[model samples]
Target: MIDINFGSLFTVELLHSYYKDQLCPDFNILPSNQTVKTLGGHQIIARQYSNQLITGVNCNGKINPPKPFTAIETGAQFTFFMQLNNPLFFNYTNLSSATPGKIYYFTNRNNNVSNGKTFLSSKIAVYNAANTYAPGDLVSNGTGITYRAIGSSKPGNTFNLTNANHWMVVDKNQYLTEADALKWMPSISAYQFASPQASVNISVLGYDNIATTYTQSVFSKTIAFANPASSFPLDLSFLQSGKYSLTVNGIQQWIYINDELSDSKTFAVIDIFNDASPVSCNLIDGSGALINPAPHYSIYFLNRATIWKYILASKQSGNINDTANLYHFANPASVITSLTPIPLSNKALNLKLTLNNHDYSPIACADPQRLVTITKGTDTYPCSEIFLNF
Candidate 1:
């Protein structure tokens, strides 16, 4: 019997061997970096413009400092879940008790830099301290010392000076200084941090353009896309000229394909396979334009143990006018849910139910106690409401 010791193996492999075939991504050909403003890490990261709590996203833990087995550089361009509970940046921030959309302003006190901060009209969207704001009117808060928005054209955006509850007032200690300010912006804001996952000088892929080969880690899975590519719909034969490659970020069974031709044609997702659960899709076009697919499909299992399926025969194209990040893609594959036909109850009630949007519905049974009224455009129909307990 031969005994093999694993401990001696580490002594065998040299440091250079670990990075032998390792390739530092081509910074040039890759897509644009996802420029963003990083807030706090491993610590409570927040911001204030004219003295209010605009947004204070917390860092993993001891953010400003490094910990054991945790590299400070890991928090460099990205935040780590090990330090912060999220470990992932898919954070959903909404208006809550302590948080609300607040105005963030950046003014050149000295006006030294040629291209000083440019002020963008504030909206309901999130704002970091990196933005430019013109103080509106200086009004007194209930505390008597009031803060104001910079622009006079609009009503003065004021904050409570007494309490730090406002979105623009973080404790002097928690606020980010100018040195670490850019991290609080959006990732796509620059070209450095996000360079690794890009293919060419493009940040987001154009229709039919091949995306840079990259890997993304989400939750507990690492998804790799083959030289990420894009597709646009044309005559079906034209699209067939490209080769199809696939990489999956979900379970190994789930798949997404990258079909790219040598020339710059539009890229289209060939298929999404092995998705047995409820899901949604975003249908958009090149230049991040949202294209409404006339025919759309959906399938989902409600939280109450019921399955549903829908097929949209047509859509109102106007709905796709939102921005790139806000665009939605539609389902290309047939939605397969566990929606079995069940017999409707025979019971009849005074207040009958009326359902609409029958265009996306398939032939299925309905609850006898309720009435169904489906409408696709001007056409309308009332399904036979027969009641039989059996």
Candidate 2:
């Protein structure tokens, strides 16, 4: 056996030649410049603003500097993890300290320039002696005494005081001379540094239009840049066509996915099986507005009893007004105070639930003297009427 080092001078064909005698000879290495962000690699991490006392989050991982990495350039995306001890959460809570399972998402709003600095055009200047500086240098003389040097210059202590053209102050303060007096002094305010936060929070919520309630409650998770990276992808397909809320730490945003056909608003082809008949029909309400099938079906079953009561009152006394106040969407939980079977006669006529703008259910009522009361939670709907035609 012989050892061979490709040493960056490699190709798929070269590797395949050595294994030409094998069954599967196709082999190649992945290129290093792939754009896909992976959990296995290093990523920059930052904090998300919130009202919690998290102190700080520390991840034992490394941050891969932004593409074209330089002292001025920062990465756009952050790759992090969710580990037990690696993230090391420190919440100021009483029970178990921090909320064990929280969710979070990354955002680019906090991607601020270094010290919020702006790179501006520089001017030509000469070297100085009284002051010491470097080329491509930007220095703050004091709180507001800042300068950018087009060329290296040390124009002595009073050069800037005499408005020397060698140095340029970003903003000349009202006390400009006093600030420039201590340009090179070892002042604590001169050194500025900012390290990005270690972790961020994410929240996701889903909703359904027909259900009139959240598809699911808001879920939260926190991510950190820690050792033994514990990263995972999130799925939010359950929201369907309705709007959703996504919060990264404290910043919130609403997202709406347009799944509706642009040409139509009242109809929706919910379950079409390759252009065939007998698929689930378009779900619509009395107003012809499209609605979810599950929620619509639930409303039909819930109001089954109320539909029966209305039919009974109308037929017995030939009084259509007796059932006028009855709503099509009846409450299924409604109680039956009394249900009496009226004798059938030639005057009796069969009425369909669909005629009253209600969905078809298996239940049917032939009697005209049935009294029922539907109790929905704490509310009660009592139907106790003896109809009589005047």
Lowest lDDT block of 10, candidate 2: 295-304
Alpha-carbon lDDT, every model: 0.20, 0.26
| TM-score attained by model 2 | 0.16
- Candidate 1, residue 341: how far the Cα is off, in Å: 51
Compared with the true structure, the alpha-carbon lDDT of candidate 1 equals: 0.20
Give the alpha carbon lDDT tens digit for every residue of 1-390 in model 1. 432211100000001101123111111111101212322221223222221112222212332221212112311221110011221111111101111211112111111111121111111112323344322112222222223322212134433333222222211111111211111111112222222342322211112212212233221323243655342111122222112222222112122112221122211111111111111111122222222321122110000001122222332211111122221222232222111211112221122111232222123322322334333233232222332111
Q: Which ten residues in a row have the lowest lDDT in candidate 1?
A: 8-17
Question: What CA RMSD would candidate 2 show?
Answer: 35.5
Error of 1 at 214 (Å): 21
